[model samples]
Target chain A: MSSFPPFTRLAASLPDHVPFVGPEAIERERGTSFAARIGANESGFGPSPRVIEAMQASAGDMWKYCDPENYDLRSAIADQLGLDVEMVVVGEGVDGLLNLAVRMFAEPGEAVVTSLGAYPTFNFHVTGFGAKLVTVPYRDYREDLVALAEAANANNARIVYLANPDNPMGTWCEADAVEKFLAEINPHTLVILDEAYCELAPASAIPAIAPLRPNIIRMRSFSKAYGLAGIRCGYAFGPAELIRPFERVRTHYGVNRMAQVAALAAFADQAYLSEVVGLVAAGRERITQIAEENGLKALPSATNFVAVDCGADGVFAQKVLDNLIAQGIFVRKPVARGLDKFIRVSVGLDHELDLLAEALPKALATARI
Target chain B: MSSFPPFTRLAASLPDHVPFVGPEAIERERGTSFAARIGANESGFGPSPRVIEAMQASAGDMWKYCDPENYDLRSAIADQLGLDVEMVVVGEGVDGLLNLAVRMFAEPGEAVVTSLGAYPTFNFHVTGFGAKLVTVPYRDYREDLVALAEAANANNARIVYLANPDNPMGTWCEADAVEKFLAEINPHTLVILDEAYCELAPASAIPAIAPLRPNIIRMRSFSKAYGLAGIRCGYAFGPAELIRPFERVRTHYGVNRMAQVAALAAFADQAYLSEVVGLVAAGRERITQIAEENGLKALPSATNFVAVDCGADGVFAQKVLDNLIAQGIFVRKPVARGLDKFIRVSVGLDHELDLLAEALPKALATARI
Candidate 1:
């Protein structure tokens, strides 16, 4: 190799592969647009009309950089969560916040615990920071809390991640079980409760904001039920001590003003959020029905997406995903070992679901073992 | 000290202070908004009508996450600069990109060089990554390029930052001088050439984009002449080898889709850009004339903002700033040693400038020592 500027051995060891391929890239490669655009679990229903109006109304306000403190949005989020503003720190998205939390807590070479195939973004961050990942396998398609707690203790991990109503698998452990996990995990481990999908999940999957536990930081996203994923806004809530460290390294002005406006307006429209949750539930049921018609089993989900077992190996699931993509649909499959047998599908608009319905049988037949 | 959770010794020593307090925070504290919001070098003229229309046109597209690859925007920007897409990387703002650059090149305790009172955000990033900052003094109110190159070699610095037509001082070096500085700096030292004010400056102030310059990364922003600071979009152009490492740690979806639409539209309209640049040049002249009417020497500037020597010490300059603030005319002043005698004012709309013109004499009298 030609002599190159040195990277920290940690950085050099890491490959340039990203955790997820964005939808636009897929379109570019396929030389076609996705007809149903529901793969990322974004709310195709869109943000509240009031939020769109707010953003359009403030287009001229683009001259000013967003408030780094995110004072107004932080206050709005704090009031809604019934916590002090000091307990919440808003970020670019839940993804950005996860990176910050991992950097703050996990030292180089220390193990970070999480359920296998939970949220790969968290694992990406851990690996990016050169922290070792200790993954516990899922049981019953849900995060196996007891096993994760033991792994944290055995590894003396610096952090443990759990996403209630998890992505990829679309499974969950209820609030009581989460509390049990918190109590059982190594006290030294900082539990990052990623609830990015919590708003769409059954309320039972979320806990009352946990401020007493200094080791727990819970993250939530406006991208889910709020329908503002493109704007990149999310916040994390925790004890002041754990939350305050984000100030040290965060891109203070990373979240833009439009995101602030959209999120604030989204928060104000509780009626709209209630409607979105109901629609997501309906979409999930509709997708499950589509899976049944295709002779596959749809896993019971507490999330906005359902994971349908392809009734064969990862290769078969891959074929199903490829067929969908070739047919101009954009759903994805989990690639982690056991989870690879299922293809994940996000709830979409009626037309999009119809497209899915129209194509699933064809895609399934294409993927026959 | 009371016992606390352990932070790395270096992190524990870092202070909690931010590089700058925002104008919004000032308004909240003062219980009134600024009549002339011109301190931060933002385009008070606002984004192009076409850009605003584009954002409004796509207001409904906020449901999806931004393309992680930033495909279209990168392609547009790279095409504009006559470079390959691989040579360009978009970030939240130059501030966010600076953080990533420092993280990649300079390990903790490594030396980074820059002018004494250049862009403090760059210094903030350097300090953030635990890099030692070796600052060369600004001579003649402009960056002393010879001294900067000397210091870079002296310290064997990994990065050297220079903001032409610099912030706080508002001065520039011609293209030939910049090219000379680049040649003098060691190949191992990555020079971050921040041309944030490039669009507003004389063309001679910026050199031709040199894609082969392995030692330099030029930072530009939509936040300036494009009038989209609230959008949090900026890009760095450099050799592919240096830019490739950014992918290792960057938040893939950090840029927003609204920003992409707005920038693409902004770039598509060069006639509007020319009109805005003309207005900026006019505004700078008006600001300079206003400062001279009060008997303060307005430094010759190639940027959107002008630095007026308050004709006294740091305290007097600070008084002028506070007096402007008290009169609801928001302005900023330098707090560093040599530059503390100057107050910086940005170009704003006619009425906003009139507000500043009306406040200047009174604020000056109040600051009289």
Candidate 2:
């Protein structure tokens, strides 16, 4: 073999596959912009006005690097969660944090578990790190917590990832069920409880943030509910002992400076967050109503997006998604066997949803043919 | 083995040491702010007005995620460099890219070579990835290319890191010298040529962008010259084949949306960059004059900072640094044995430099006592 800049054995073995292609790439390919952009579960209601103002004010200060320690933002997050500042670690986003978490916990060739069609970014990190991914499929459109614990024990998995108020399908396990699931996981297996959508989730769907556990890392993001996805800020909290190790492997200044400022401002303006939460709830209902009008069944969701079953198979659901995309209404669907029958739509601005409502019937008619 | 959240063997063995402590942390501890903030080599000149405007304009759009592909920014960088977009990869920063590059090339226990007392963050990533770092001492306050090349050959290093217009010292190697160094390296050993400060260096220091080599990855940043360090945007370009691997491991949306917008504007406003570069050169001269006035020798610099020799040992230089800090002026110094006698001071505004000038004599007097 040619020895021109040899990559590591594992890196060489990994395929070049991105988890999700951004809608921008599709727009570039199609030479047309999506008329209604609700595909990726981003909040079209946008960030709190205070956040925008804070970001604008800090624009000139971009010449200085961010506080590598992420002190203030982490402190605020800690205060809200009723945890010590040392128990929280901030990252570029949940995506960036997952990469660090997987690297820390999973040695190459070690087993890691997640639902088959859960977050693709987690799967990407596991494979990128050369860990064996043992996936347990969803049961009844929810992450099968019982199966995940069993798989973790069976494979002696190093890490198990579960997204509460999960993505692709917005079903969630209640607090008590999650508490029982945690009890069943082996102590050696680190649980990555990603709650990126938690702020948009029902209060009943979330467990109390206190009484932090060593084997569990609960991650939350400004991306989903706070509507700061473009800024790329997220954080993971756990026991201080578990959190301290992140310093060993993190890109210290990976979190952007403006992100810290925006997140701090976003966090402080609880009124705006409450408003966005209310708006998101209303949008979800609107989407469900639209789905019903089109003779599809929308799954019960605690997330910012709703998964509407197409009343058909995976292929038919895919055709519906394609037809929606062609009609300039961007949407996505789960790719796994059982979940693929559903088309996922994010809560959007009223105008965007109106466009979605206008296009759904035509998309369905075309998809049926 | 109590078995509570077991980390990888490498992570378990790692110490919880942050590479560099932020100035904010120091202020929090001291309960006082630095009057002159020039410690971390960030541009005191700030980013271009157009860049700031771009960032402010895009603040409200933070609800949308950054394009994971980094298409427009990469295209702009490619256009500026006269290279195909395929040959370049954008990252959070040179620090972030270093983490990816090290993980891509170095397996556990593999040797990675760098000059001793170079960029600490690079060393952090090297060790963080379980790579053994082989170091060569700088000769005459400059990174010793001959020693580094020999070290790589002797140790069979998987990767060798070299920062042109080197950090902590602000010294640079000429293009011809670097070309010779690259020619001597084994093709199997990848070279991470960091030119983060290249925009501030003389044209003779930068190698031509064309005639890309598979084994050499040239990394540059918007942080130093464009004055957008807080935005955390950097790029690396090399042979397209080598650049392709970065996609396999990078956090798809790690680069922030505001960062991309800010960097694009910064790159476009070359006139403003030229103006900042001129101001930086003037500031460097002023700093050199301040060192001379204080009866200390200032090392020649190609970057934005001057390393002032205290005319004593590392201990004496450290005293001067501590006294300067205590006197409300922020600065840093090299810690490696041979270079530790010099206190590194970044170019600041005239008023800040005056504060440095006024404090330097008092600091030296206290050190001498």
Off by over 4 Å in 1: A1-5, B1-5
Which residue pairs come into collision in candidate 2? none
State which candidate has the highest lDDT. 2
Q: Rate the local accuracy (lDDT) of all candidates.
A: 0.86, 0.92
Clashing pairs in 1: none
Q: For all candidates listed, what's the TM-score of chain B alone?
A: 0.97, 0.99
Report the poorest 10 consecutive residues by lDDT, candidate 1 chain A: A1-10
Write down the TM-score for model 2: 0.99
Candidate 1 lDDT over residue span B1-369, tens digit each = 112334444456667877668888998998888888988888888888999999988888999888898888889998988999999999988988998888777877989999887888888878877789899998988999999999998998988899986887889999999999999988878888998889888889889985468778899999988899999999998888888778888888888888888878887888888999999889989999998898989999888888999898998889888999999988887778899999999989999999999998998888884
Docking outcome class, model 2: medium
What value of lDDT does candidate 2 attain over all alpha carbons? 0.92
Find the candidate with the highest TM-score and give its number: 2
> Can you write out model 2's per-residue Cα lDDT over A1-369, one digit (the tens) per residue?
235788999888998767669999999999999999999999999999989999999998999889989999999999988889999999999999999999989988989999998899899999999899999989999999999999999999999998998998999999999999998998889999999999888888898886887799999999999999999999999998888888999988999899999999999999999999999999999999999998889998898999999999999989989999998999998999999999999999999999999999998899889
Separate DockQ for every predicted complex: 0.62, 0.78
Q: TM-score for every candidate vs. truth?
A: 0.98, 0.99
